[model samples]
Target: MVVKMNLKHVDELSGGRKRFRRRYPKSLVPVLGEAVFQVAMKAREGGALVSEWESLMKTYDRNVAKAERAAGVAGADDRLSPLELWREARRDAAAMLAAFKDDLTEDERRELLGDELERREADPVLYRAVVEPDAPEPKPTLLDAKNMYLQERLEGGTGRNNKNRLDRVCKRIEATLGPLNKLSLVDLTRDQARTLRDAMLSTRKADGTRLAPASVRRELDMIKAMVSLGIKEFGLQREADNPFIDLPISSKGVAPDVDSSKRDPLPKNVLLAMRDRMREKAQVPALGLIWRLLEGTGCRGAEVVGLRREDVVLDGLYPHINVAWHEDRRVKTKASIRSVPLVGDALVAAREALTLSEGEPMLFPKYARENGPDAASAALMKHLRTVTKNPRHVVYSLRHNMKDWLVLAGTSERVENRIMGHTVGGLGDRVYGGNDAKLKVAYEAMEKAIKGMP
Candidate 1:
């Protein structure tokens, strides 16, 4: 018979996977395997194994009696002593165990181990064995389906160094919800998932700083993904709900992101001041160009940093730069991989960068490491802080201010979205079409907006 799990709604859920075990007398099952014998001894040491032991003994004796009657052993071996009959049963138990040991596979062992841990937590005999004075520490679990998902992603070439992030997420999951580390997929109930969500919201960094709503939200997302692995790879329980799915992460009380630099529009005056400052400084070869490109083209810092000599087509009829993804580098989105007309300070900066890095494939080689985009953002952030001399004004504010610059110039939202290399907002948005007339209009609007700078 399959034993129901110890989960909150185990009684209600059908077809539980746990085993229904019956204990037997040690002599009748003389060799259940050395490991099993040791565990039983440890359980008995604390006086907790007696009931299970007696129950198994009775079951074994009853089964042997039925077998003897079926073969007419009572009449054929009537003179055989009771002690001799038990010895014969012991011989049969040893043969069965030896056959089981010969055929067990690694996959079966791991599943059994995870299941055993769940039983030990509540079983009096096993719980006593667990708390024995010199018992060995329980082993860490790394065989779960959630961990298997991580392994597949890490091995697959789809994401770059995503395993490290996922590994940290796994550790955080274990720390936030202690039982999750040891639980099987079916054992993870909806109620436990709800508890984990609250735990993550209240969690703080090691330095005692509470997580931002976005960070907490990401943690919840990761937890959901982990649980989904079990549902997708194996299967979810039909009776009990999977809390990771359809659970709302309520952001009712959390304030909007107060940091002005984060997706906040920069005032036009401060935007111009930062632009003028970058232009004034000529010591660094392409620093000014990077900043000016962000302001004029509305392109991300990484997109500018990853530009190749071929990408910067100053001699072309349109005089625009291509922002396509190369093998060594990546653009944020497919829309972000389009040509942006070089206008105003951006045109001057591009000409200067071409003069400096004439033969080099990459325009900005310093930031074009494997993860160039992230590095470029960091580089620009420091420059913005230094040039503005204000904690509030950031390099990213330049991109934010560009949207207003385009709209205020009466540039259609459609054209502005294309020029800015942003995702289309409406249902009938334009596809990738960089005709000369549209590029010229975008160039004129950008030039007009940034003209009266310095």
Candidate 2:
């Protein structure tokens, strides 16, 4: 006889003991490893194993009943208790035969184990279809790709330095601009530019003086550059619709005009007076020499500051200082990189300043504990301001004053532009003819004018 058991689900498998759909007493067979305890559970959960377990349970029950009946009647082997009889029945040939037949039953067993194996093999393709069922997936963003592209052209060395400076300018614009500025900058229109021009003109400096029109104009130029970059490089706007294209900018009233000799260039009397004062009042003769160099050479504040001793090529046919590669020097253009012949007071000053340095940097080495080279330039300008009684007319006036002399002596605009590292015809011109020798000749003409000055 066989006991019947119901089907069981697989999820019930857990911690040491095994449960089964079939009910049975503990097995008389001695258990082996931990897995033996789950034999009842697995046998019940599996349909073929359930039937085998039930048959084994029934055989044990029958054998126990036969042993109890035999013991009560004082039959043969009365010493064998019911419990002993049950244990003995586990090894009985009759019970073993029933279990073997159940194990081989064709009706109860299914090839589910093989089915599971088949499913596992196909899972990867099936799972991919379920998770992403349509078109091809997109690649990662191009931000890192863009950075990698720019890394070579715009991210390191000299190119990187310019890129970083441009970033700084952007930061400064964001900080300095106000809400009304948004109206002007947002659309980049001519009306907006004119409105901004009016707005900036209405504003005042820290001291409450009305800001100069020229100051407003320079700032507008910076805004124009920012807008141009937005349209050209960043693709923020369409080129045809770019507002900076034909804006009406008032070139009227900007300050610190390097071209305005009347406002910027130290008057002849002022220049002479400052030179005399510098010779007498400066701590060293070398400081007096630097003053004369600025007065004579018209070198930019940065170029003069960055001048190292080795840039002085004193042995050439036409001896001139190479302003191109001064350590901190940023020539406004390639034309500005050309050599300007040293002559007259400027030559004498350059020679005198060179004598003071024993192959180091400028005639005046930077002071220790300074953050930058700006301090020395500031000092030179301050001293000149004190002597000239024109605090506004700083050391850069040297360049202004020289340019004024150039213009006053009938130097052409192209020559002045070359001397100043400026280019004509706009963006295309700068890109195509980066270094024109014709412009270099014009710069040389400025040097000649300075030499011929009284």
CA-lDDT, candidates in order: 0.57, 0.50
Top candidate by TM-score: 1
Poorest lDDT segment (10 consecutive residues) of candidate 1: 2-11
lDDT string for model 2 (239-331, tens) is: 324444545545455545444533576777778777778887877565576667666667765565456676776674455666775323445
Pairs of residues clashing in candidate 1: 23-56, 24-56, 24-57
Residue 446 of model 2, lDDT score = 55
CA shift of 320, model 2, Å? 0.7
lDDT of 1 by residue, 386-453 (tens): 64565556666666677777777787877788888878676555544446766787677777766533
Give the poorly placed runs of model 1, Cα more than 4 Å off.
Answer: 1-168, 179-186, 204-215, 229-242, 256-263, 266-284, 387-390, 432-441, 452-454
Off by over 4 Å in 2: 1-198, 207-209, 212-214, 227-258, 284-286, 325-327, 361-364, 367-373, 404-454
Error of 2 at 75 (Å): 99
